[model samples]
Target: MKTLLSTIFSLLILAVPFFAQGQQTLLLVGGGQRPQEALKEWVKANPAKEPKVLIITWASANKKQAYETSIQADLREIGVRQFLFSQDITNSFEKNEFVNNLSQATHIFFSGGSQTLIMNILNSDPQLMNQLQHAYWKNNIPVAGTSAGTAVQAELMITGDTKNLEYGLGFLPKTVIDQHFFKRGREDRLRSFMKQAPGNFTGIGVDEDGSILFKRDPKTKEFNSTVLGSKNIMVIGPEINQFRQEKILRPTLLCSQLF
Candidate 1:
């Protein structure tokens, strides 16, 4: 643990010196299907640190050893040549090991499964999270999560409750993300869910075998999104209101207008 902390601190210091010189590239992949090719392409193109992967078990949302093992192997085959995902995660020792591994990785790949569980792990670890925050702001290491992982990236995760959206460890503050969009008929529920939204969050729903990769332009400080393996990444923004009014306008709605 001591060794890990020292290492994380050293990375933080390095990021500062580089900032005075220039910016670093950050990638955020909303999980789904296979993202290995994209990762390889990104690393091959970028001159930053070697692309390393972190397959968080927290998102796997499972305690079954067999299930976790399967996820690990699947990720390895996908080009996570250097990674922290391994074996069964059933205790703090394993958790610490994962955190320490995250300290060095340039990329974070969240596997599909449970969002709440992952959020809890992050919430439970103060020291580990401290390292993550430092690594994020100082180094601008790219962060990506798929399915439940993607859900947690939103300002708040909808913890299986339509009445009340649960609190999430916010990464992207704009909106909540839903995976397997069209096939699952999430439109109605998502539409209703947005009605209770506290702010203007872009509701992003992706289909199976689909994903979103965000390009963090070091020079522009803007995160532009690109979709892969599918068509029409649904964006529930202000146009939604125009969509509603253009068809059937209604009153007594309390929420931010989305396009």
Candidate 2:
């Protein structure tokens, strides 16, 4: 019985890599002035000839229009022609329509605001969350987010106060994501959170104006992270309790090459 259990455990460990196959690209931007180069990378990730970008502004309330306008201008500059805003898709009557629209989107972006608001809405409806997972995992559509939007990408998300942790959208598994790293002086906060966190998860603290692009290698079936933008990105592994800062001098660099 002991030998059989060991064999089963080994098989499950080997199957992990296969389960992570076919995941699409994820672009996580640290809140602040979004680098134009990051936007270009996002636009380039879309494989569609006529890419339809969907902007989810559930995190923003008063700044929804402003955020949409700014993102639209940036996306337009990068040759994006079609755009869909989720401002009106709030009620039950529009849920099906929103899901349909998400299916057609070549790229999905979440605007910065409050991660709590985004999760609250998503958690209330399982169908919406499933559709988003389908779009990102099965459909291979690129998903991008900034600030609070970026926080939701992780399974463990640091709250606004930097004191408590909450369950996020789980787009990025077994990871704790924090934004505004240096500017907000959040290194200590992240370290504390990581210590209290349940599982052995890596903590990623993205500085303002910095971005991390997570793309899966088709052959290896493993996600390779690339640092983009002008500032530094802090990565704390489960084993390494100390902070490791990686400065991005160039436009793009693989995290594998760095650490």
Candidate 3:
């Protein structure tokens, strides 16, 4: 009986990777993103692929593990073209280097930390802001956000205004995303953002080891986003069922929704 139970457990563990095949994704860990397994997959997907992806970390609040030098080192080791948003400018250099790189990047990663810190950099530099504006609209590049990094993708951020918490970047123009969703028990907070923007924007609550894929079809101008690695995403909008059909989409439901 013990042997039978052990075999069953081994099979289940082996099946984990296959189950997540639906999502071709990577993790965006913060000060500490739980689930080392997820990080391993992220490293594998981003391994030294020629064009060498770029990472623009903006959410570093405290100067602890969020140091720019450290992040650049990690990215370079993985063969990524790392550029500190705060650096890259010289008397004769282009002020929008960060922005240009953003547009040209195959994959752009937003590291975790303080969302406000990222907002500060964008606000301080107009050139960078314009470049980000361009990247969000450009379909050629893929944007990956983690933790507070994920929070900025939405049009409205559920930050604390009373204490001067950072707002959002409004790149998504759809919903506010709160990371550590289930783990942090932040579903209610995520819903708050949806409530304020009711019937309009969505609130995405993602737990660690979870991911959502946003895919666009050029010929038909239609898009289908798939979720994997964990629980299905919650779609909050007006007439949510129909609204989900309109925007909030994922791969788990792709067969039925896209067809």
* Candidate number of the best lDDT: 2
> Sorted by TM-score, highest first, which candidate order results?
2, 1, 3
Candidate 2 residue lDDT tens string, 1-259: 1110000000001122233446568888889877776777777887688989999888986899988998888888778999987864468767776787787789999999998888888888888887787778776789999999899998888877557788887777667888988899988888888876754566788888788777765566556666666666776665444443333223432223433
Winning model by TM-score: 2
lDDT of each: 0.52, 0.74, 0.49
Clashing pairs in 1: 31-145, 31-146, 237-258, 237-259, 238-258, 238-259, 239-259
lDDT tens per residue, model 3, 1-259: 1110000000001111111222223233322333333332344543346443565555654553454566456556545553535333333354556656665565566767667667777787777776665554443445566677777765666554333223477544455667776666766665555556646455566666455544333333333454544343454544354443223333242243421
Stretches off by above 4 angstroms in model 3 are: 1-49, 63-100, 160-167, 219-221, 239-254
Cα-based lDDT at residue 228, candidate 1: 41
Backbone clash tally for model 1?
A: 7
TM-score of 1: 0.69
Q: How many steric clashes does model 3 contain?
A: 4
Higher lDDT: candidate 1 or 3? 1
Tens-place lDDT digits, model 1, residues 46-93: 354555766565665454354345445655664445666633345888
Candidate 2 runs further than 4 Å off: 1-21, 240-259
